[model samples]
Target: MKPLFMLLLTYLLCWQVSLGQQNSYTGNGQVTFSAGAPLDLIKGTSTAITGSINQVTGKVYFEIPVKSFQFANSLMEERFNNKYMKTDRHPKATFIGEVTSFSQNSKEVTAHGILSIHGVSKRRSIKGTLVKEGGKFILKSGFVVSTKDHHIESPKLTGGFMAEHINVNLHLQLIPENVTPQVATVYPAKKGLK
Candidate 1:
């Protein structure tokens, strides 16, 4: 499953190359999730994230390795990986989509795409803030994920300690792509370069 996410990312990069689009940015991001229950709260965070966005095309992609998420309690982490997420089998969660109604000057943007997790794929539209500062693009969003939708079964042994809905948060900071395609460029042709 991790290989599949890698393949998808590679394919997107190749697609960018094929389109001669260099006006892009790719970098490491962060993902955090929190869930509330009657007994206690569950929280985890992961920094092993990679994502990219094409400035000219409004395309976006993000990938998260399941095992990268860290929990405060080792036992919870183990149970999360072994019983809930099954990270050994399905190792990644990914999203690929296009930004709609986006602009560098706009404060809010939306990305509509498919979210694949736990071997289940669903169409999800995420709305977030888009901030451009010092030549970097920052995107942040918060959303909810239903465990049942992704086939992530909570342990009945918890005595209903887990919530059915998981709150997810994402943060990405990206800089413009420095490498440009040799044949076709993403940005418009400069004067006398045509």
Candidate 2:
């Protein structure tokens, strides 16, 4: 008779390989803002930030598609996709940044990286707060940006409605990607998103 232990080990190895998947974590959060006037002029989010965090090196890799940005109103949607952002042509924005320092001895880390949008890339340094509860991680950060700087020309339709500088925020939570598929990240105020 075949060795019983060997038979069991073979069965387990086959089962594990049959359920093959990737090792990944998703992060999510929201960007609450006053927009310098609080006219519902902020983008909100619930994005599944797919990436890995290396504890030894402290590197964070995250990605979001340009088309993923959504708006609360129809006008907002058109204004974003049809006008300023031009998400259709330039499809995605990726963040490949590093958490150089953390305060929790490992809790809150400072994430600095390049944020590319509207065909222009800018180096941004953001303060990110993180909490590890279980098989997940939560990240929240926001920064101020001027549309003019990125050459985002506000369309004529606005009756002087658009603000010169918009407050951009990112609140995100991430989970192991192998557990979820086609995970969607939505940003309501992403008029200038991706």
Candidate 3:
């Protein structure tokens, strides 16, 4: 089921690019989570993030594979996916929302939408900065997610190993489909040297 979800996301990303729609951008993105308890520090990151944005509509979407997140320690990673996250049951996290008050002149923007994780969906708002450069849109944002809100279990045995609130950071560089030149289907028949 996880593989199927990933495949579908890939297909959608490709479709978004192939459509060649104006003001639409898509790219591979990154997400990171960090937290600290009294005794233990928890940190993980996943680069296997697929995302897209439609500037015209101020809409954005992101899909992240739970198994893709990596921790510094193998045992921690194992426990995260198997015990805490239960990746087998809920293998992916997704977000879909609209960027409110988005404007080409404004560097800061607010996004409001649904964030689904651990089989639970919750309304969330994120604040971030956007910069357009070299034909790419670079976005950065930070938000907090509560473990209890998503029904994530915190075992007593793992005391002080996890924090109640998780800090999530996002960095995305997106290329507009319309601005990218299409690959030439057929090379111009060898041009004769003048």
Best by TM-score: 1
Worst 10 residues of 3 by lDDT: 181-190
Cα lDDT for residue 62, candidate 3:
86
Off by over 4 Å in 2: 1-24, 27-36, 39-52, 155-162, 176-194
Candidate 2 has an lDDT of: 0.60
Q: For each predicted model, how many residue pairs clash, with residues at least 3 apart or on different chains? A: 0, 15, 0
Clashes of 1: 0
RMSD of 3: 11.2
TM-score of 1: 0.77
RMSD of each: 11.7, 14.3, 11.2
Q: For each candidate in the order shown, give its overall lDDT on alpha carbons.
A: 0.84, 0.60, 0.82
Error of 3 at 52 (Å): 0.6
- How would you encode candidate 2's per-residue C-alpha lDDT over 104-193 as one tens digit per residue? 765767878876667777787767677776767777666776777677765432355666676666766766555422322332444444
In candidate 1, residue 80 scores what lDDT? 90
What's the best-to-worst order under lDDT?
A: 1, 3, 2
How would you encode candidate 3's per-residue C-alpha lDDT over 1-194 as one tens digit per residue?
A: 54456666666776666665758888877899987663566789999988888877889998999999999999999999998999999999999999996656778988889999999999988889888888788988899999999998764334445467888998988887655434323223344532
By lDDT, who's the top model here?
Answer: 1
Who is ahead in lDDT, 2 or 3?
Answer: 3
